[model samples]
Target: MTPLPVRIAGTGVHLPPDVVTNRRLAETLDTSDEWIVNRTGIRERRWLAPDLATSDMCVAAAHPALAAAGCAVRDVDAIVVATYTYDQPLPSTALIVKEALGAFRALTFDITQAACANGVQALFLGSLLVRTGAARRVLVIAADSASRVTDPEDRTTRVFFGDAAGAAVLTGATTPGTGLLGWDFGAELSYDVEIPAGGSRQPAGATTFADRRHYLKMNGRTVWDTATRCLPDSVLNATAKAGLTVDDVAHFFLHQANLNIVRAAMDKLGVPRDRAPITVDRLGNTGSAGVFTVLHKGFSEGTVRPGDAFVVSAIGAGFQWGTLCFRA
Candidate 1:
């Protein structure tokens, strides 16, 4: 009566056709392409088209995953999408994706608004469903269009976000330690000092518009300090829980939020720089899609192998941070 293992059967991604390059943005902001590239390692990123939304990208990405898994959407028992930027206000993107994928039997829901950490969070949650025998298979999708939240006038924020979606199918198996080994989550809610004019507390209005409340605002320095301090420990803790050391992990799939942040965490964790798989140079930060986007890149390039150990981690909105250790 032992529990089953959760195995990732497939991975897929969808990036909008539009490419927003740093050079293109440099034409608007006071920043230079070199600065953005040196700091973030992002030369260009995908942006959702005017007609597309998070659900659209998720649905598109899900199709390939469903195909790879060799199952119809109806075979999934659950759907989970991790994103704060949904196409609509109600009904959840999970349901949107469910209908989009023609999923009929799955229970659907969304997860934390923890910006970049979401992809891994969604994956970890989906694993629980299969591991507990509550689900035969689950669809975990993370998609976001941060272009709307970014303030075009703010050089720092403007160059950091883009749009993309990634999907994974987790199926139940009789194998041991094949999927998620362990995960750890941490939060610093006091840093909830977000732009106060967008939500119910201060609904968007003329006054809010005047204050530019719809844009994403953050205590960037503070978050940087916290991430530099918190992220490594989260990785270490999760690795320890998984009964592995930093050296034991073959590839690191840290959040692709920024080049500096990833380097800092690898330095702090004492993991070699080359150990991490990265894609920010071309994808920017896809919010919750960051981890899987990198995962997809690695998979597409045939670099990831079966039995390879990996460390996936992130820190973002809500000042949340966490990590998951898994085997490919």
Candidate 2:
């Protein structure tokens, strides 16, 4: 029997109200706004208040997404959250989001692999659930408050992350070939970027806090090189698998990791600059939420239209990367 085609029915996003401009960081840090902007193309980023958690952002994003899909919370059969910055370690953040949204019937879980690419990964899984008839409507949410884990004094990692959440509703597509075309995911398994401690391998302790081992650590150059090479290849492979070419794609939704890396991938794929919409300048890198946030903004602005061919791609800390092609 032929399975149903999965499509993204609706999308929504929530960026915290509190804005932190580059100039604001310059007030206490040794760096200036110009330095941060020139290096990262980030002028400002949103930071959630201490009181809010990842699940809060997820709920905020999910309501609008479900509404847009013409689906009620009770109609959803599954909930998948992609995040590394959960409010707690034991209970999955997806369960908390489910409770907040009152999605009582949904099977809830979290995807922690692929770090920043977890959004695309979750979307892929949601597609599978709907296509396989295991779910009727699946809510895929990606949220992060990287500011909570960032080392304030570490300018490199601190200037690049922000707090945000994005959600999408997936269901069976009525139009044939009007949903996901093809997708690919891969990992290079390098620790060039990682949080050194707080996990089971290196449990958190007083010394961990003293040494700042819990903060994110990154080798920017290594990431730039690996992502630049791997991302374009992933896109090409997925497009080929889908029997399409780069020229057929009308919009590109690459991850908002860094402007320079995005530009590099565009150049490699021979995609024109205007074809890809970027959000890193204003939102910073919202971890797994980056791609979904970009997608939501594009849809809201009418930049991504129906029947348009678009590709979404990302690479994260674990050297994980994924690319998916879709027809809107």
Candidate 3:
């Protein structure tokens, strides 16, 4: 039997009220707002309060998403929380969110390692659960507390990330030829972006703490090269897989990693600049939440119309990248 198409029933987002502007960052760092903006195009980003964790963001995001979907907590059959900056490793962040949301009947999942691409992966899993009849409604939350992982004084990594969470409710699309239609997911192993310690390979200890090994490390140049190439290609591949062309896609929701990267990908695709919605300038790089932020914006503001085709894509620390083409 042909599987049903997964529809994004509703979406919501939670950005901490605490805003960190580039000028504020310059108050402590050696760099200025001009330099940061010229390079990253990030003028400001939200920071979770010192007291909160990743799960807090997830739970906050889930409320409105479930409400928007008209789904009760008990009706959510599965909860997928995607974040590398989990509250901790032992109890599982998904379970924490599920418990907080009072979703006792939901099966919880954590996509803890995908970094920025975690949102795409979570949405993929949500689609599968609905398409396979394993779930009627799935709540997928992508969030990250990047401030907790970056060195407080490192200008390189600290300036580029923010804390945020975005939630989506997924179900089978009753309309034929709508919902998740085609996808292209691919990865190439690379450690150019990683946290050097805090796993079984190197347990958390005084030495790792002193060296800041738990903090995320990234090669900006490598990220630039890889994202510029892989993202556009993946979009083309996925669009083609759906038997559509670039022109057929009404909106492009690429990972909100960098404004320049987003522009470059669109340039490579020969797509116009306005076709993609961007939230990185105000939100910075919210890791897994980036895609959701943009998606929520497009959706809430009525940009994503019915019968229109759209493409969502991203890349992560595992060098994993994917594109999902959908009709709504």
Candidate 4:
């Protein structure tokens, strides 16, 4: 299949006001700031208020992205929302965001279950729609309210997650070979990280809720092993497929899963750490919003420029990992 040329015109992010610091968690859990920082490299994270939902962040993020791209709500051809903790099960999260943004004319797509890698999945769809001429302007949003699902009392899971949303506007690139390029995606079935209930396999019920079955469960060591190994391998494979190497790329937007994981990928690739920016230190692991936040930072800071080669990569729950290469 022939690929279409699509470029990211703009990027944006929305972080809730409430900051959950390691010290704050230490208040409730038997952990210390130094311990959290040394292990996860996360000092603080954002948590959405009880009144707000993931869609609210998506709407907030969409406005800046649309403005940055010089496009309006009515002009957007599609809206792709990637999330796991949707507001509810009945109504689609994408539809909720579209209504809020007043982007009624756009088609909506919901990409749930990819967790941290949802952003890459949404990007693939956004690029496809633009390349096929099915949409001139595509709004891609990645958001997750891990605050809504994780066991709050469990320090192991709660300390590593935060709530936030990130968005990007994709449009056809005028320059040839300056859009979506090579990619690599792989997955292995594993319950290393997962939400155990609320689905058909374990239906939501009084027993499920009472037993605390409807919550996020994770195997931290398994996640660390899978991520450290796959993130770099995926990036290398994707870059090589694009006829480029880590040295040839100017910037790398990697999943904000862990600061150490990012460093490991850079070390494995033998590239300077500055080539990949860090946000996990401040925002923690924002699930699907992780990679997009890095992308937003790079674009807003003017770190990514025309003719620059860049790559976005992520590993999510379900042991899924992927990388997308682009020529900026």
lDDT of each: 0.83, 0.90, 0.92, 0.92
- Tens digits of per-residue lDDT for model 2 on 1-328? 1233788888999999999999999887889999998888999999999998999999999988998888999999999999989888978899988988888999997998678998989998998898889998999999999999889999989999999999999998888678888888898778889999998888999999899999999999998899899999999988887778999999889999988888999999998978889889999999999999888877778887888888889888898899988888
Query: Considering lDDT, which of the candidate structures 1 and 2 is the better prediction for this target?
Result: 2
Off by over 4 Å in 1: 1-4
**lDDT computed for candidate 2:** 0.90
Q: Report the Cα lDDT for candidate 3.
A: 0.92
User: Residue by residue across 1-328, what tens digits does model 4's lDDT show?
Assistant: 2335889999999999999999999998989999999999999999999999999999999999999999989999999999999999969999999899899899999999888899999999899899888999999999999999989788889899999999999999989768877888999999979888888999999999988888899999999899989999999999888888899999999999989889988898999999999999999999999999999999999989999999999999998889999999
lDDT of 4 at 279: 95
Write candidate 1's Cα lDDT for 1-328 as tens digits: 1223667788899999999888899898998889998877889998998887889999988988778778787788999999878876787889888887778888997984777777878888888888777888899998889997889899868898889999888886555557677778899785442556767889878999988887888776876788888889998888888888899998888888888888998999887899888788888988899988877776666777888778778877887888888876
In candidate 4, list every pair of residues with a backbone clash. Answer: none
The superposed Cα distance between candidate 1 and the true structure at residue 262, in angstroms, equals: 0.9
Instruction: List candidate 4 stretches off by more than 4 Å.
Output: 1-3
Candidate 4 minimal-lDDT segment of 10 residues: 1-10
Q: What is the Cα-based lDDT of residue 33 in candidate 2?
A: 91
Error (Å) of candidate 1 at residue 123 is 1.3
| TM-score of candidate 2 against the unseen true structure | 0.97
- Which model is ahead, 2 or 4, in terms of lDDT? 4
Candidate 1 TM-score over all chains jointly: 0.95
Report the CA-based lDDT of candidate 1 relative to the real structure.
Answer: 0.83
